[model samples]
Target: MEYFELNDGNKMPAVGFGTYKLTDPEETPNTVDAAISAGYRLIDTARVYTNEALVGKGIKQNGIPRDQLFVTSKVWISDNGYDKTKQAIDSSLEKLQLDYLDLYLIHQPYGDNYGSWRAMEEAQAAGKIKSLGVSNFPDYQITDLAQFNKVKPAINQIEINPWNQEKATVDYLKSYGIQPEAWAPFAQGYDHIFTNPTLSQIAESHGKGVGQVMLRWLFQRGIVSIAKSAKPARIKENVDVFDFNLSDDEMKQISELDRKEGVSADHTDPKTVLRLSKYTTNLNGLD
Candidate 1:
């Protein structure tokens, strides 16, 4: 349950419970409830996830005080203009059954992001969104937006795992006082991540699983991470990373695992950008 102070002087949990693919309408609420019960204070959801209402139900069911819980949602690429992004925020609040969000992010960089960022700035000033950030934004996008925006991005959510460490991007964002948040912190268990000898050896030494080692490495590197799991046991295990430390040698061994490429989609591709722009499915159904 470690925390990091954002550039705006707010505290964000270093480890968060991610709700990326918790699509089952029934499973979403149950899993979110389990995560909250397992000591998760940060709940990350997105409009594209289409499970905000379920996540809200879980929070309401848990009965955790609103101020004690940190809820985050994002503005989808389809809702990219200033007016649309602002409307999207209110829609998210209504769906999540909350008055304000702890954090709100521009879900992608390929949009009228400058316009969207302006809306986010207005929302923060109006107190509807406490903090602001972006997801899948590379180094240049942050610089381009931050240079002219009223409020700089507080964080950048990107895919960060051993195979795609994004060290350079993280360092660049840090220089602008932006915190780097790891989305797929375990590479989604691709390439036999759990059975990797280097990670397994380190996990063995610490009596932890490979997932725990990956999360610990992110924490030690000062990156915020979100790990997703529908099972309560695995959800609990993701948070049990603070009990041990990774030695410098062990850390280096893990650091050397970076391939500096995304395990999933490539946001840098123009085709990806064009594809996202056409993805106007109206995830929130507010349009």
Candidate 2:
């Protein structure tokens, strides 16, 4: 697996396993173990996912050295504040059964993000979190946060897929020196992404699947990506993207397929802010 060096000088795995909806107590751990067995060292979860304990169990089951694995979790919207975020950090460490997290992020841009960032900074200074970042934050929001905060954000994870290329945002992020991480790299197979003609043609040319092509495209752009899957075969397939390379023309063809839209919620919408703020979870309990 390849690694990306963050602004803080921490090396993060380029392709990470995303546990967004992998909530089954019995199944999540096994899948996570399988992913680890398939050479995935980066595992991303969130307090909102309500499966940190299970993910923790999987980490133990794999028996890999703690330092060799990169575990990440997030502070949910409800936990956004200096006090709540500090507590949330400890709660996550307890649930994940880890001494410290390799990375911790603000799940959303809403709430008292400044307060949350301050808490994150403290956690890093205290050695509870190795690196701090934000998710679903636009370029402007990230810029403001980075400029004012003592510690610049190491990463900004946002939607980037064939339909939502986010070219301008990505360019700005790179220029600003914040590593761009891609969430929903496959768009959750939206709009029949796996069967799209352009992607299929590109896959055929490279003797790879559309998923691999997409991941390779992101890799070529120097973007870290998170891919989620419950099936072991799919989990193994997602990480097998380092074998091939996409040419400049193929990359351009894929770029042409961008629609500048995403399948996920709009972070800028007021309704989104309202909904996420009210979406509370019991981090102490597993789902």
Could you say which candidate leads in TM-score?
2
Span of ten consecutive residues with least summed lDDT in model 1: 278-287
Model 1 C-alpha lDDT per residue in residues 1-287, reported as the tens digit of each score: 78999999999998999998787888888899899999899999988788889999999988999988889999888889899998999999999999999999988888799889888888889889999999888788888898887888899999999999988888888888999999989898889998999999999989899999999999999999999999888999999999999999998998899887777778888988776777663444211
Query: Estimated TM-score per prediction?
Result: 0.97, 0.97
lDDT of each: 0.89, 0.92
Residue-level lDDT of model 2, residues 1-287, one tens digit each, is: 99999989999999999998888889999999999999999999999999999999999998999999999999998889999999999999999999999999998998899999999999999999999999999888999999999999999989999899999999999999899999999998898999999999999998988899999999999999999999888899899999998999999999999999999889999988886777886633211
Report how far residue 170 has shifted in candidate 1, in Å.
1.3
lDDT score of residue 145 within candidate 1: 90
Backbone clash count for every predicted candidate, in the order shown: 0, 0
